[model samples]
Target: MRKPRRPDVTTLELVGGAEALELELHSYDERWASSYLEHRRRISDTPMAGKIEIQHIGSTSVPGLAAKPIIDIVVTVDDITAEEDYLDALVDAGYELRVREPRHRLVRTPARDVHVHLFEHDDPAVDDYILLRDHLRSDAEDRSLYENTKRRLLSKRWDDMNDYADAKTDVIAAIKARARAARGR
Candidate 1:
């Protein structure tokens, strides 16, 4: 007998559409951070728990960073389709899958107003994000370094938010390398 086929987990695609990501600036606010946790709290109550590990990531999670003020949540799961068991729950909570990065096992929020980054545990992207987040939170000097870079970049006019994101890649990659060395990862 032949083995059963499974849904491919390595075909995740990026969120690329005409949809412009609003990369604006906002003063730090605890309320915004709290909302992220609050949203997770509600998510905990959803049926998605069996397949999802939700997280609050991105600049919004980093305190004192001038950001677009959107909450970035990382929902870790073994499989996005497996979470169909909780699809209704996510919808009830007002989250729609936007980006589909098949190669990376990720799905972003359909609406960027609140960035929901979905990923699987085995995915390197999840670990990379957590490592960077922890590295930034624990080291004030590094945080300042990142903030300075961001400020410098934000000062310039951009064609769109995508351009802004691409520009940060170089600095972020360098910082992540340092972060890995510091943590011995």
Candidate 2:
């Protein structure tokens, strides 16, 4: 239960812009699932995997949705704020810690393609991500709406990846609302 350590970033620029420039949405690739499986295997082989809960999320996880071809994985750990617990192990596994913010920690492969989001176990954000992913998996209408929104916004060059992600917030919130309401019924 040690506090998370700030990433060793002297060697790299803060990643938002450097990372965003690398984003280019592509038509859904069937290989994304296989890629996820491969990543899952690699991650599972790591010492931290036993304590980590992994899942494929974001548009890349949704079949038929256009995405950046980078897989988004949500990993729940005992205490996301405690990076010392797993950061070194993850780094050893070839993942570099990228963003470290309250409530979230991110790591990515050397190529900066796959994003691994770490949340504390039982964090609501984990539920939100999984809920949206599950909802999209089952609801074609919302899925289409989300995909259309992304496709429309993808052409713009964003200075920061967060800006691009922000553009989708409204749609994501709306869809999540609907999903919540449906479950309440």
Candidate 3:
């Protein structure tokens, strides 16, 4: 791991107006699942995989949510702070470091539609994401509720994508808590 360069102007410019954009709803289709898995597999085969573990996550991975048509991949590494040399691999792989959200994780993308997350395993929030995704998969009621909320949100005008994501925090937190309690945590 080497020291990371300070984000260049392009990276800074890309992190613009974090608003919740309107969500586009699509029927629960096998294509989304298929595409997501295929993309995940392709990403995993990349050289980046030697340094990162990739997982398909987000609403699209949930199987039945009305979501934006982007496949989200969460990639975990040993230390994000140390991956300076590997950042170029992502760029060469056609990804843009859109958000340098050092607080949670440094999220990037090979494209705008799909987000490819980069995180250090030391970050607990990555675990949260994995757990929440697992919980949604296990609980049918939770899945239904998520789909309903997604439909309602998609029907509205959002300031940007962040607003829509922020709206789901309450329900997501509730479901996470329920899952933990049920597991006797």
Which candidate leads the pack in TM-score?
A: 2
In candidate 3, what are the lDDT values of residues 56-86, reduced to their tens digit? Answer: 7877777665567877788777556545544
Candidate 3 residue-pair clash tally: 10
Q: How many backbone clashes does candidate 1 have?
A: 8
Per-candidate TM equals 0.80, 0.87, 0.80
Could you give candidate 2's per-residue lDDT for residues 1-185 as a string of tens digits? 24434432233235453444646778889999998999888877788733788899988898878788789998888776567777788889999888876777789998868988888777789899988998998999998999888878877888777788989999999999999998893
lDDT of 2: 0.81
Report the Cα lDDT for residue 35, model 1.
Answer: 81
TM-score of model number 1: 0.80
Query: Each model's C-alpha lDDT?
Result: 0.69, 0.81, 0.68
Angstrom error of the Cα, residue 31, model 3: value is 2.2
- Candidate 1: worst 10 consecutive residues by lDDT? 1-10
- Candidate 1 local lDDT, 1-185, one digit each (tens): 12213554455344454444435577778887788988788778776655567778877788776667778888776654454655566777777655555523333345555766665566788888888888887878878888888888887877666588789998889889999999786
Best by lDDT: 2
> 1 or 2: which has the higher lDDT?
2
Candidate 3 regions with alpha-carbon error over 4 angstroms: 1-20, 103-111
Misplaced by over 4 Å in model 1 are 1-16, 81-83, 86-88, 103-111, 157-160
